[model samples]
Target chain A: MTPTIPILRVRGHLLVSVQGELGDDVVEQFQNDVLSAIERDRGRDGGLLVDISGLEVVDTYVARVLADTAAMARLMGRHTVVCGMRPEVAATLVQMGYMLDGVETALDVDDGLDRLGLPR
Target chain B: MDPSLTEVLQFDEHQLRTRLAFFRIGEEELDRLAAMRPLMEEATAQIVSLFYEHLLSQPETRDFLDDPVLVDRLQAKQTAYFLQLFEGRVDLAYVENRFRVGAAHERLGVPPRWYIGAFDRYLGLVRERLIGRGVAGAELVADLAAVERIMHFDAALAIDAYVAGHLATHARNQAALRELASPVIRVHDRVLLLPLVGTIDSFRAQQVMESALLGVSEEQARVLILDIAGVAVVDTQVADHLLKTTAALRLLGAKTILTGISPQVARTIVELGVDLKTLHTRNKLSDGLELALSLVGREITDKERGS
Candidate 1:
């Protein structure tokens, strides 16, 4: 069974908090879920915020999944701001040469809301 | 250049023999030293007492020998050391023992000048005794030459150990300075300031990366301003390191603003054709801070202090 990632709505912005390492299938499911949530929240100017602070490790595969989700969200007329990325995970991603270049980043949920032009 | 700690510690029998040969202390000198052992043994206690007497007279040396119990113990050790010189068995064991003596003096914080002066005084006493004992001209000169050569050899070993200890301490201090050089200061909430100074080398660049990344994580910082006004040069290598750090910070949800680029460094960066499109740079640290503040969804608005 694929573990489901929590995707909550805060101020109309989708906040996805990833905890621990995810298997390949789980990450794929998360990507699909994030896109579906963005489609469900259509007509509302909400953005995506992924909180990977609790994730101890983020290999290249997980990083690509998040980046892909952000790219798909952009096509649906919504922005995605990745927030609460731990430093070690960032370092690992950078070392592995996987840069989520087009995705916006913020410090936390409040900053994420600010990025989406929402009241913090 | 001073020898490394490993070289000093590994002063083997071959090295000892080479040093003896360098000092021209051949079989003849060893024979002379053995021949004069009885006379030197008789004068050992007197020599040690006289040496300590001269040392105790000096204010600097007197401070180190303030305790009478330690003085007594050291005096006994000095007597044995003096007698060992005349016994003429200058082997690896003997050289190793001399190294211990030098290391002990170094640990005690005794300066080189005092010990050197003490050796001179000790040699003078021995010369005076040899004359007083009615030793003739040619034999006296030969014995004195041997004694001087041996003293020189012992001094070399001790000084080597002393210098090696100092070099080790210098290395430890340098390591501490490297750690201090890269300080990640949290100038504002969710914003960090790393003011880098000195020349950028690969080692220091690694230090900067580790410190900045760890600082961002611990502070949960959203923005970092790296002010490099004090950095001496901006070569391609340095630019590469800075870019790598900036890219890493971006992944951690932090925007890195490079600041404090001097006019010359700016020209060099342009001339060098280093690509810095992904990095945000400002002229001064304050400007960088402004950019950083804005990135974190905050701004520094001017208002009355009372308000």
Candidate 2:
């Protein structure tokens, strides 16, 4: 089995970097891992930042999973910012009718950090 | 009817017959015209010269008539056309020939009134000549009536071809305008501007969407400012098109700022309840530009007065 993606605690905020084309199982595992990380960091004041800059493509299923993760994080009292989506990927996602609604976006990791109230 | 000829002339035999019937020209009238053909054939030269004199008097035609060779050539052609009227056969060939001449005149930018007026002069001169030859009473009236009906019928066919030419030119211009309608401008390093003016029909809306996507991807634009102040109407359909554009732009990682909302348009949007939550709108283009600059991490500041 491929190992689940990593989630790191950076300056009291959870940071997740998703790269390349991840399989459905890997994305689901990452979703569970992110939720638990958000649960464990419930006392933290910062938001969750997801950096997808390394990802070249994102299918509708993966987009849905990310949006779900963001909503779950918000429910846990942590706002989530998904950043670094390439222009083509974003265009394909919107064209495919997967809007990724209810999720905040940033230009890159730095912008994501800035949105999360963490200056870098 | 020849399909190719009818297609080019946009007139079939049935249509021509209908026009002739409308002008009340029947076999009796055609027979009368054919009988007078010899008389008209003899008078063709005199009538054509008189017609040219009238043409030379007009400022628009004087330029073409200045060349003696050209005027002689035109007069020869005009004589043949005048004699053809009294030939008494308004067949497919006759209709096709008239259509071709009309289209040629349109290409040369000759106004309809000039050709119509030329026909009127020819008719008047023909009546005068027939009477001068001592044809009297019912016979004079019959010939004049037959000539008038055929001339008017010919005029109708020519005008049809003229209108067809105009419609083709209009369609060509519209296609060119559509191409220039949507232009995406890259104002800053990572900002693009698309100023939309006029109505947003489905065809133009599709163009706008394609331009926006291509512009955003090409420029790697972080923010796209769409100014619709020149857009006169803000209906539900226009709002829907704008929403789709913004939604697509969002996926491309570029934020869309809609500017140029007149107060009247703002009221219409509210009245329609267009659900503009997904879109970011500004009252003026300048405000949208300011916001777009900030989104791309750049701003204009006053220069230091004393360095």
Candidate 3:
């Protein structure tokens, strides 16, 4: 059985840490969980920090979904930041023509949280 | 119609009949003479100059006819068309010839409004010129009536040609857009085959998305086999496009089977750290075809079936 990924919430920031192959199913679940957390914390200011350190290469679909999710969160008055995208993974995503337009990217989760103005 | 009359008008019997019906005038000598009046007015240098002056005064028409050489050629062509109207031959051959000329201009992207405006100005000049000559009574009215009929026919021809040209251009643009979206390949009832031939880019990826969606919607296809054997190399960009397209297909409830990944492409995908384990990819088109048939619950017999 595949190991369950962990989602840790610190204050108003939600941290999604996955340690396996990030496929379509995993991406769908991650998106749902993040949206649910944002809805649960509605009317309160918060942020989302997605840590993808375990992932080596992020596919085009997931990249697009991440960008879309970030946009959606921003529209709901929530700031979203993506962190720990490996150089190789970032290169792969760039080659795939995934526009990282609205989503903020950082070297690590700590930096990502800092960018969101949330205390680590 | 006499053979000489047909030769001069360059229209067959059927075309002449259609044109005569459009003019609402028969092959009678008086009606034929009346039709010549408009042509005579159009051929005169004074009326032609007046028509040009009016066209040049309008910015829209003036811009299109800015080239002096083109203007000269157009004037020469119009003069010839005018002379043909009074050739004393009312046949389908003459009408067809006129239609062909109008169609040629339409293909050249000349707007119908330009031809109509030019004819309108020509008519006004003819009316002024004839009235100033002290012409009156039924004779003058009959002459004017003939001129109007010929001009109206010419205008109709020009408009028809313009419409045909616009339709043709629209169809061509649609086809190009469709091709850009997806290289569509028709397959048998149980099969949906798409061959990837050239380089794939992001813009092409969107096109592929539209095309694949259309194929799935129209064919109700149970099996979609994408043949990439013709592709030269599978770069990361191309691979990403394929992955996105596959994901989109799945969302639309369509199953996509990729085929024709050369060994080099396999190595590249591995080197790039892209995972293809979730995808049903094959090395050959035939293997993909077999898989597609199995998904559709159909068998490929030894005998070839209709496409």
Candidate 4:
């Protein structure tokens, strides 16, 4: 059984930190939850921050999902920023040919929030 | 040279003797050894013969004796070595010879394990001969104890030399590999070239960042051309490292321009949906240089002044 990833809302912004290896189904479910949470909040100015700092390696599947989430968030008028991409993980991702298109990245959560310019 | 090897070479004969002084190997023992010269001479031939016979019996030992003539000569050399250990006076020549012997063993690819094991058999043979001499009681006990110290000290010197040589070779290879893998070269007055040639793992990636950054600061380079023509893969981890390196260079007031990203890498990045738009990139080194030159207010106008 896959543990559902929690998407927390702070100051109207949705923050989803992927903690471990997520199965494709779990990632898809998380994506749906994120979109639903954004709609429920009904705050178009608020953005989504997907943190992948906890991940050691983001495979081709994970990379695609992350990219799509960014695109979908944008479509919903939410800015998505990826935070805490480790140096080694980034290198491996690039080596594996992941450009992480449309995913704005920051060093950490604080940096992500700053980039998003959210209140409080 | 490796620091360990340098340390080993520094232990001269006087120092080594003093360090092993706990065994009470002094002038009195030398006198006793000289007094037993006849016994040493009488036992050497038989000891050498027995030593070779024992060595030849074991598959591990027989491998060292590749040529019959060479083995015969080594047996004679072994006889001299056995006699020299009990020859009264410990001199620089003795330690020097031991070092040469160690160097030879290293060349022969004879690991220390084999030689150290062989010492035990040599000591056993020597003990047998000492006992057969009928030199009994306290005298025999004292003589044998002294003989053990001499042999142990001998083994220490040889093994020390062997280890030193091995470490030196190992250090050399490590340095060579480091140079080949991570190089930060200055191509122009303010532009640096880092041509990554091998697979970039996390460790190498970190090293690349460190050395490249150091070069940036040291050379005061305005632009770093990261040429990955030789790099075969750029997994997410590798890409992350590249970005991190670029970010670091940015902090130092230097711009990082990536070049030589092949079609497969490009396809992989696009397929994975990685956004590399934030970085300044060019298809080739020449294109990157053109941009770098422009950044420094230098332009390459055609010499003919017309197409």
Best candidate (score: lDDT): 1
The digit string of per-residue lDDT tens for model 1 on B4-103 reads 4335688876887789999999999999899889998888888889999999998989988999999999999998899888886788778878888888
Give per-residue lDDT, candidate 3, residue A112.
67
- Report the lDDT of model 4 for residue A40: 86
Candidate 2 C-alpha lDDT tens digits along B251-284: 5557899999888777767776756787789998
- Candidate 1 vs. true structure, TM-score: 0.60
**CAPRI quality of model 3:** incorrect
Top DockQ hit:
1
DockQ of each model vs. true complex: 0.45, 0.24, 0.01, 0.03
Task: State the TM-score, rounded to 2 decimals, of chain A in model 4.
Answer: 0.89
Question: Which of the two, 3 or 4, has more lDDT?
Answer: 4
User: Tens digit of lDDT per residue, candidate 4, span B1-307?
Assistant: 4333324588665685675686578887777778878987987888889888998999997987879999988987887888898788777677777777887798789989889889999989988988988879999988888788778877877887888778889989877988778888887888889999879998788788877767776776778899888888887668767777776565344678989888876766566565566578888989998888887668777788564
Candidates sorted on TM-score, descending:
1, 2, 4, 3
Off by over 4 Å in 1: A36-45, A95-97, B1-71, B74-106, B109-175, B189-191, B271-277, B290-307
Between candidates 1 and 4, name the one with more favorable TM-score: 1
Q: How far is candidate 1 from the true structure (C-alpha RMSD, Å)?
A: 8.1
Can you tell me which runs of candidate 2 are displaced by over 4 Å?
A1-120, B1-5, B59-64, B185-192, B198-224, B229-256, B262-267, B282-307
Q: Please say which candidate is ahead in DockQ: 1 or 3.
A: 1
Give the Cα-based TM-score of candidate 4 against the true structure.
Answer: 0.53
Model 1 interface DockQ: 0.45
